[model samples]
Every structure is written in structure tokens, then in C-alpha cells.
Target: MSASLLAILVTSVLLAAVARRYDLSSLLFLVVAGLTVGLIPGADHISGIELDPDLVLYVLLPPLLWSAGLESSYVSLRENTRSIGLLAIGLPLATTAAVGFVAYRTVPELTLAAAFVLGAIVAPPDAVSASAVGRRLGLPRRTMTLLGGESLLNDATALTAYKVALAAAIGASTSLRAGLETFLVAALAGVLVGFALGKIVVFIRSRLDDPLAESAIGLVAPFLIYLVAEQVEGSGVLAVVVAALIAGQRHSTAGYAARLQDRAVWKAVQLVLESFAFLMIGLQLPAAVEGLKGTSAALIVTSALAVFATVIAVRLAWVYAFAYLPRLVPRIRSTEPPPVPGQVFVVSWAGMRGVVSLAAAFGVPLTTLSGQLFPGRPQLIFLTFVVVVGTLLLHGLTLPWLIRRLDGLGDQQRADLLAAAAAQDRAAQAAADRLDELLSDASTDVDARAADVLRAWNQRRRQTAWERIDDEGVESPMATFRELRLEMLAAERRAFLADRDLGRIDDEVLRAMLYGLDLEEAVLNRG
Candidate 1:
């Protein structure tokens, strides 16, 4: 990387870290900081940093999608498929049409095609912020799952629409029927490509014992799947998401070492990429503004704010419509419970646009096929910038307060914990049964003390899970055990390090012992 880019990354990361320290939205913080810096005198170098559209779509997006997919709960996703599908596919298309129509009517200079391009640009909400806020607020599992699943697939919807709209803007023939066909083909091809690659990766990783090699493959897989799918005229976003979901489903079968390394590596990668992307969203503000030189300031402000309002309003309507309208059917009402108004409202308000919108705007063609300047290209880009930053500041800042006000979800969260405790109890019982079966075998030579230790461990695991649902003030037995066990583990770690320092233990032996201690601590913390 160039020194300038490295500096930008460091600066962005620092701003994000500060935001995180104070429980602020890091993405919003970075964007605001970037905008502030961009406006400073002699900060042209920062604001002038140009990014290729392909860099955002091809290079930056895939890994982020992959990371989210890997971390997603397959069970939750399956259960909430209908909700996710509505938000991912339907919402994007609706927003594209709604925003496109609004933009076309609002900006006299903008062609219908170019307006739709702008619409597609800002249509998809980057759920990174929504997911972060939802997680921090301890939103119910189903809500989080819907957010995760929507984030994974919504990009595909927006980008596919973007392609069709862009083709029209550049003077290519496109009709509603053709656009629908294109979307269907892209979605199908992407899923097939991603599924095939995902299975291949899983099969290879499952057979491999090398953590470093597995990690390398995991890192490369996203980009590879994206490129291959796009090469076949499919939605690269869908391909990456599909491959990630497939790979995530098999994640537990991987070696412990690979899983540990993956957690550290992917976490760092996500932080760096997300920070840089959010900062760039802000840093590009000057260029976006510079593009509209000589344009009426009043016109610019009115158009931008109008588009922003439209974006927010459309999401609210779409979410609420989907949440309730389907349940009006007698059959549907009988099959599914009514949607929680609080959850639906939270989902609606969490629609913050991100780097992708800016990237799409920046990618717009400067000139049409007839060699005429693409109508309102500069204005559209500026409008997109405004919408992104405006939504970020508006929604990102208020979501926490909104979630706090609508606090009825606490009961649902507690219910989820109770369900988890029940599941843990069954799993622990099964483990104990398997242990007994192993011990009963004549070929097994385990010590009686070792057998007792295993049995106690299983019982403790069950108790720990159940303890989570106990009264908050209660000092449960499992909690006490965890506290004491953690202290003991810390002591063991210090002893191991002391032995290593005194040259009494080999480095490899120390690492092995430390790994064991770390795994135990991880399990305890997880419980």
C-alpha cells in the first residue's frame, strides 16, 4: 500500500477506536470525521483520494459479505427466511422504483434512467451499522438474523437493478420484462456458482489439517467466488453471500486451530475494511460537491434532502407493509404469529446507506452514447453523497435511543435464553451418555478420576447455561465455578510463562499448553 493510503487507514482506525471506546457508532463517527477533515484547508490530498468502482464492488465488498455470512446463524436464517427475503429482494426493488420516480420528478435535468441509477445507488442499506446497533442493544435473535440475512442478499438486488438502470442510462435498450429476466438469471447463476465453490472449499478445508493454508483459502474464496460469478454475468454479491453461507454451515467441522485463526484474522480484516470504507464515504464529500460547481445551492440542498427523505420514508412503508399485510390472510395468520411492532419499527429506522451508494454514484458514466454529457451526473453524485451522510448521521445517532424506548423486546431475549438453556441441557446429557458408553467399553483404559472429571465437566456445562436464565441478582453455582476456574486458568498461564522465561519449557510445549488454557477460558466465557 502507498504511504498516503496507509495514513488514511491508520487515521480511520483511530477515529473508529475512539468512537467504539465511548459506545458510539464507529462507522458514523468515521464518516463525520472524514467530512470534517475534508473541509479543512489544504486537505485536498485527502478529499481527492479516488477509488475505482470495481475496487469497492470487487475488492472491498466480498470479504465483508463473506465475514458476515460466516458469522450468521443458519438456524435463525432458515426460520426467518420469509422476513429476510422480503427485506432483501422486495424492499430494494420497491425503493429503487420509489426513489427513482421521486428523483426523476424532483430533478428536471435528470433522465428517468439516470434517476433510477441514483435510486439503485442509494437503495440498499448497508446493514453493518444496523447489525452493530442491534447486537449492542441485545435485539432478539430473530431480528438479528433478519438483519444479517438481509445484508447478505440485499446488495445483490440493488446492484442487479443498478446494472439494468446503468445500461439504460448509457443508451442500451431495456424494458421491464428484460430487466426482470436479467435479475432472475443473475440470481440463479450466482447461487449455483456460489454453492459449487462453497462445497469445494468445504471439502478441501475439511480434509486439510494446516491452519495457515486453510486461512489463506478462506480469505481468497470470497473474491474468487465473486469474480467467477460476475464473469458469468451473475450477481457477484449474491455469489459471495451464498458461498459464505454454505461455508459457514460447515464451519464447525474445521479444526480448532483454523477456527481460532479465522476469528482473529477475519475480525482484523473486517475492522480495517469497514473503517477505510466509512472514512472514504466522508472523504469524497469535497469531490462530490466540487462536481456541482455553479449549480444553484438552493436547488442542490432541496433535491438532496428530498431524495434522502424519500429513501427513509420508503423503507418505513415497505417494512411495515410486509410486516403486517401478509398476515391479513387467514391461512397466514393461522400459520405465523403477528409481527412485533417494535421490531418492525427498529428494522425500518435502521436503514443507513454506506460506501456502496457512493461507489455506484461515482461509477456513473460521464457521457451518454450520443456523446452528450450524462444528464445530471454530477448532481446525482452529490445527491447520493448527501443521502449517505445524512442517513448515517440521522439514523445512526438515534437508533440506540429508539431501541431503548421500545424496550419490550427484553422479554423475548429472556425467552431466547431459556430456549438456549434447554438446548444446552439436552446436549450435555447426550455428552454424559456418550462418556458412559465409552467408559463401559472393555478396550477403554481411562482412569476413574479422569472419568469423574469428564462427568463433572458435562454437568457444569449444563448448569452454566441454565444459570443464564436465573435471576440477575442471584449468585448461581455455575457463575461461582466460572469465576474460580478463570482465576485458576490465569494462574496456570502465569506459571507456564514463568517456566518458558526460565528456559524450563520449550516454546512449542508452552504454546500447546497455552492453547488448551485459552480454549477452556473461551468455553467458560461462551457459557
Candidate 2:
């Protein structure tokens, strides 16, 4: 299992690297690699690399969810509330009902409850996949925001739906009213858990000054929220998301270096996890399909087609209606950002189901409490794999092209740059103010040098921001200086590499010098 796990990781990295050169997302490639590798000769004997439902739900999900929540901007969430709410809540409900009906109609083997189980299993669009692919393609910021916010919240909704549907499948009596109440309780409890944890964590973080220790806290934070929420009968996923948002909003108060380091660490973690996840999806294909014993291949395949088309069609209709309907409402139209043509198409088509769907499918109980076989566990799993793979391939491969065809980045770049420039100006002013405050009473000897360095850094920051705003129609004096400065820095880097190569300088010493140079260049070339 260890060796196979290692193989999955290595293959994921290789495929991800290859994916960078193309239009496909790394997730897409990794899933493909997983499927291909797991089907190769000896796969049955050699590879135990597959999704462990419990591990993914409890251990893996928290970090992934928290990292996303922390990275997401609360301000953006509010700005895009209407669209996100509709898609996150409304779309999932619509998809579930539509898919459930289709499955019940097309697949006679599945009871209504079992059919709804399949619906809930595939309902939520995977948040991680949306963030990964949508960001990579540089989807419109508002579009990505709506998509991202939708992904983060939809899991809890879909899972709540899944739980209610699952209980029925397992012979536990249930009702829509009970399901709705349970969903509300779980969601509310999850939020409370997250808020309480966020406060406690912030207090602890304020007292701990060590950057490494602080980062370690970040690593542990999501799981704490998740477990606590579940223990209290709440939605663990929602708890993690809320906790992350709360902690993340306050994270700016921590030391800048600590925050930066934490960000980098999470980036690496998400990459590894995302890669492993999609690969696991692929690895599970055989197991997913193996349940076809005694089930007609044609019927199941046809059923897969019906489920896929229904998922796609429902998303398209729901998103378009949601996007357009608000325009007729005077109040909503006044507050909402006007829809950009084709943006809805991008968001609708970006609905590539991924890890969460598979997790839900795998999580379905194998047998009821009476010990009779579950009505449709195997088919549920098989159809899930089909939907995940189907949407991922179809959307992941085509989204970039569709985006380009639509000229999707229109006006978004200018809006982004303006927002960024304004932010840069504020950050520079803040740093300048801080430098003065620190050097105000510094020991006399260090004050002059400190002032000079700080002044230079502040000027670079201020000037760069201004350049973006009020272009000169010709090179700014700062631009000329930056070009020359980069030339010198590059020369210094080359010299450092040569010194290491000549054996005159130890590699360690060479790296130390290069690190200083890198810092200097970064300041001079601030963008």
C-alpha cells in the first residue's frame, strides 16, 4: 500500500507537470492517470491506492476546506451573494430532484430512496476542482467568486440532502420536513462551532509569536472545527468553511512572514492533496465498475448517459434562470452586478463533479440494518464514477477554449488591476508609516541606514502603483531604473552560481548570498 501510494504521488506529479503545457487542468490529468494506471496489468495485486471514505471525510476534507475558506475573501462572498446563493442552494436542489427523477425513471432497479441517494451523491459541484480549474483559466473574478463561494457551501447542502436520502434507503423512516430541520440544525451548529473555534484560535495565535508554530496551528485548525461540528451533530464541512473564514479574516494581524509562509505551505499541501484525490478517483474506477455483476452492461451505460445529461441540462437551465430572473426584480437588479453575456455558460459548464461526489458514493452503506443488501449501492458507485469522469473530462478539457472563445477576461483585467493598484498604494503607505514608527526612537547609529532603506522600498512601492494607474505613454524613470537593477541582480545571481560551480564557495554560502540578492530584487521589482 505504501509503495502504491508513492506511485500515485509520483504519477500525479508527472501528470500535473505535463498538464501545465496544455488547456486541461492538473486535476483532469491526474484523474486520467489514476484511471489508466489502475487498469494496467498487476493493478489488482499491486495497487491499494484508492479513496478511503472515512479518511477523506474526516481527515482530508478539513484542511482542504479550511485552506479554501481562508483563501476566499469574505467581501467577495457578500458582493456575489445572490448568484452564489442561487447556485449553491437552489441549483443543488434542482439537480437533485431532476437527477433523482431521471434515475428512478431510467433505472428500474433503484428504489426512489436509492435513486435520491444517487442524486445527492452527485449533486454538489466539487469546490476544490472549481477553485483549481477556474482560477487557472483566469475566469472573470466575479464568475470565479460565485463559482468558488458556491462550491464551498454546496457540499454541506448536498451532504445534508444525502443523509436524509440515505436514511430512507437504509429503512430509517424520514420526511422532507425532518430533512429540512436537520439541514438547518446542522448548518447552524456548524457555524457556531466554527465561530467559537475561530475566536479561541485567534486568541491563541496572538499569544504565540513563533511563525513555524503559528503555521502548525493553521494545519490543525480545520480538523478541529470539523470534528467538533460532527460531534455536535452539525455539518463538519460547513464548520470547517466558517472556521477558516473567521480565522482567515483575522490572519492579517499575524506577522507578515508567518502569513506568507503559511500560504506557501498550504499551496503545497493543496497541490499534493488535490493530485492524490483525483488519482484516487481514477484508481477506484475498477472497483466502481466491478459492481456490474448480473446488471446489464447496456442498461447501466444508458443509465449513466441519462444521469450525465440530466446533471448538465439542469445546471444550464438553473444558472440561466437565476442569472436572468433577478433582472426583473427592481431591488435585486439594483444591487446585483449585471450579468456579462456567456458568463453563465462558463459557470454552468464548469460543473465538473469530483472528490466529494465520489466520497459520498463510496460512503453509501453496503447493507441495511436488517442485513439485506442495499438496493443499489453498486450502481450508485458506478454512476458516480461515470458522472465525475464525464463532467471532469468534458468541462475540464473544454472550459479554457470556451472561455477564450467568449473573450471572458473582458474588462475583468482592468477592474482587477485597478483594485490591485489601490491595494498596493495602501500597503505601501502602511509600511512607510510603520517604518517611521519603528525608527522614531531607534538607537542613533542604526537610524540613518534604516531610514534610507525604508525610504527606497517605500518609493519603489508607491511609484510602481502609480505607474499602473497613470500610464505615462512612455517609459517612466522608475522603469528604466528597474531594468538596470534587474540586469545587475541577474549578473550577481550568475556570479553566485559560478562561485558554487568553481568549488571556491560552499553551496550553503552561495545560497545565503543568493537569498539576499533575491530579496533585494523582489523589492526593486515589486509588481
Candidate 3:
């Protein structure tokens, strides 16, 4: 198992490289690679890499959710609350009902309760896939925000519904009223837990000096919050998302070192977990198919097609209906303009199912309370794998093309530059004012040359920002300055390397110098 796990990691890395080189979605490629590897001879060990349901739910989910939440903007989330709420809360429930009804009628082996369980499993579209494609294709900021915010909250809704549906499937005898009560209690508890934890963590980290210690706490936070939420019968997904948003909003208060280190750490963690997840999806294909040996091929194909089509069709209907319906109200119409049809279409098609769906399916108990095999457990898992793979391939591959075909779509580059320039100009003015005040202090010994140099650099920073906003193709003066500066920095870097090679400077000294140069280059590149 260890050797197989290692092999999985290595293959994931290579696939990641391929993804970067080709500028394609890693999720798409990794799953295909997993399927290819699993089908090949002498690679049975790869298939033996069992995806532990608990690991996916407990170990994998928390950090991924936290990282996502941490990066999400609270302000944007609040601004798009109505849209996100619809997609996150309303769409999932609607999808559950739509798919449940379809699955129950279409699949012979699945009971009504079991059919609902499958509904809950595949309802929430994975935000990671949507966000990845959106970013690569430069989707509008508002569109990105809607996709991200919905992803953060939808899991809570779907998972809560899954619990209710699963309990009924296992003969626990639950009612609609009881399910509603459970959801309310879980959601309320999760928010309280998240708020308390977020406040406590922020306070503690503020007092801490060590970046490593702060980062370690960040690494532990999601798991700790998740376990606590579950222990209280709360929604762990909601708790993690809320806490992350809280922490992210206050991220600027942290020391520079902690911010830098935490950013790199989370990126690495996201990469590894996402790779493992998508790969496992494809690797499990053979097993999912193997479980259906005795089932009629026609039934399997029909059931898969029915469920997959229902998932897609329902989302399209939901997104389009809600996009225009609320605006029919006079008050709503006055406040918000009608959404562009293209953006609505993109959002609708972006409903790609991911690892969470598969994990939830795998989590369905094998037997009922009466010790009988859970109705259609094997068939349910098979359908889930089909939906997951189907949505990913179908949506993930076409989303970029769909986005590009929309004329003038997401053309916000110039607006972004203008906004950035305005902010930079104001900040530079404030810095110059502070410098003048410091220089005027009678008690301080301020050098005249140093003050002039500082003023010049501050002025240059302000100029660089405005210059970047220029529509003209010709290079500005600051651009020439940057080019010359980079050349000098490159030469300096080569000199340091030569000194180290000649034993004239210690490696530690060389590293220190290179670090300084790196920071300078980073600033220059930003300009």
C-alpha cells in the first residue's frame, strides 16, 4: 500500500508537470492517467490503492475547504449573497429532489430513500474545477466570486441532506420535519463553533511571533474545527468555511513572514490533495464496474445516462430560472440589472461533480440496521463514478471553449489596471507625506541626500502605476528604467554565484545576497 501510494504521488507530479506544460486542467488529465494506469497490465497495485472514505472526508476535506475559504473574499461573498445562496442552498436541494425522483423511477434496485441518498451525493458541483477553469479563461470577477462563494456553502447543504437521506435509507424512520430540524440545528451550531474558533485563533496568532508556529496552528485549525463541529452534531463543512473566511479577512494583520510561509504551504497542500483525489476517481473506475458484473449492461448504461443527464439539465434550469425570475419583482429589478445570458449559461454549465461526490457515495453504509445489504450499494457507487467522470470530462473540457465563444466576455483587464493604479497613487502620496513629516522632526538626524533619494523613489513608484494603465503600445520611461534595473540585477546575481564558486564567499552569504536580489526582482516584476 505504501509503495502504491508513493507511485500515485509520483504519477500525480508528472501529470501536474504535463498539465502546466500544456496549460490544461490537471483534474482532467490526472483522472484519465489513473484510468489508463489502472487498465494496463501489472498495475494491479495501483488499483489496490484503496481510497479510504474516512481519509477523504476527514483528512482530505478540511484543509482543502479551509484553503478555499481563506482565499475567498468576504466582501464579495456578501455582495453576491443572493446569487450564491440560490446556487449553494437552493440548487443543491432542488438537484437532490430532481435527481432523486429520476433515479428512484429509473433504477430498479434503488429504493426511494437510497435514490435520495444518491441525489445528495452528486448534487453539489465541485468549486475547485469551476474556479480553475474560470481563472484560466479569465472569467469576470463577479462570475468568479459567485462560483467560489457557492462552492464554499453548498457542501454544508448537500452533506446535511445526505445524512437525512442516508438515515431513512438505513431504516431510521426520519420525517421531513425532523430533517429540517436537524439541518437548522447543525447549521446554527456550525456558525457558533466557527465564530468562536475564528476569534480565538485570530487572537492567539496576533500575539505569536514565530512564523513556523503560526503556520503550524493554521495547519491544525481546520481538522480541529471539523472534529469539534462533528462532535456537537454540527455541520463540519460550514464551520471550516466560516472560520476560514474570518481568518482570511484578517490575514493582513499577520506578520509578513507568516503570510508568505502560509501562502506557499497551502498551495503545496492543495496540489498534493487535489492530485490524489482526481487520480483516485479514475483508479476506482474498474472497481465500480467490477461491482456490476451480474447487472444487465443495458440497465447500467441507462441508469448512468439518466442520472447524469438529470444532474446537468436541472442545474441549467435552476440557474436560468433564478437569474431572471427574481428581477421580475419591482424592487429587485430596480436594485439589480438583468444578468447577461452568456454568464448565466457559463455558470449553469460549470456544475462539475468532484471528489466529494465520490467520497460521499463511498461513505454510504454497506448494510441497513436490520443487517441486510444496503439496497443497491454497488449500483449506487457505480452510478456515482459515472456522474463524476461524466461531468468532469463533459464540463471541464468544454467550459473554456464556451467562455471564449462569448464576445467581449470578461474583458476587465483595463478596468483592473485603472483600479490598481488609483490605489497605488494614493498609497504613494501617503508615504511621501509620512517621509516629509519624519524629515521635519528637529530631534532626528535626517540626511539630505537620503531624503531626496526616498522622495525620488516614491515619485517613481507612483509614476510606474499610472504608466502601466497606458493604452499606447510604446514603452514608457519607467518601463525602460525597469529593463535597465533588471539587467543590473542579473549581472549582480551572476557575480555572487561566481564568488561562491571561487570559494570567495560562503554559501550562506551567497544565499542571503540572492534573497535580497529576489525581493528586488519581485518588486520590479510587480510594477
Q: Using TM-score as the measure, which candidate wins?
A: 3
* Segments in model 3 whose C-alpha atoms lie over 4 Å from true places: 470-473
lDDT tens digits, residue span 1-527, model 1: 36777899899889888988997788988988888988899988777786568879988999999999999987888888888999999999999998999999888789999999989999999889988988777787778888888888898999999999999998988898999999999999999999999999999998998999999999999999999999999888888888898899898877888999999999999999999999999898788887777888788878887898899999999999989999888998999877888888988898889899899888988898889999998888888888889889998999888988995566556777889999999999899989989999999999999999999888888888888988888998888888999999999999999999999999999999999999899988973
Query: What is the Cα-based TM-score of model 2?
Result: 0.89
For residues 277-326, could you state the per-residue lDDT of candidate 2 as single tens digits? 88788888778877789988789879999999999999998988878987
TM-scores of the candidates in the order shown: 0.94, 0.89, 0.96
Clashing pairs in 2: none
Ranking 1 against 3 by TM-score, winner: 3
lDDT ranking, best first: 3, 1, 2
Global CA lDDT of candidate 2, please? 0.83
**Which whole-number lDDT from 0 to 100 does residue 350 have in model 2?**
80
Clashes of each: 0, 0, 0
Clashing pairs in 3: none
Of candidate 2, the 10-residue stretch with the lowest lDDT total is: 43-52
RMSD of each: 2.1, 3.5, 1.7
Residue 413, candidate 3: C-alpha displacement in angstroms:
3.3
Between candidates 1 and 2, the TM-score winner = 1
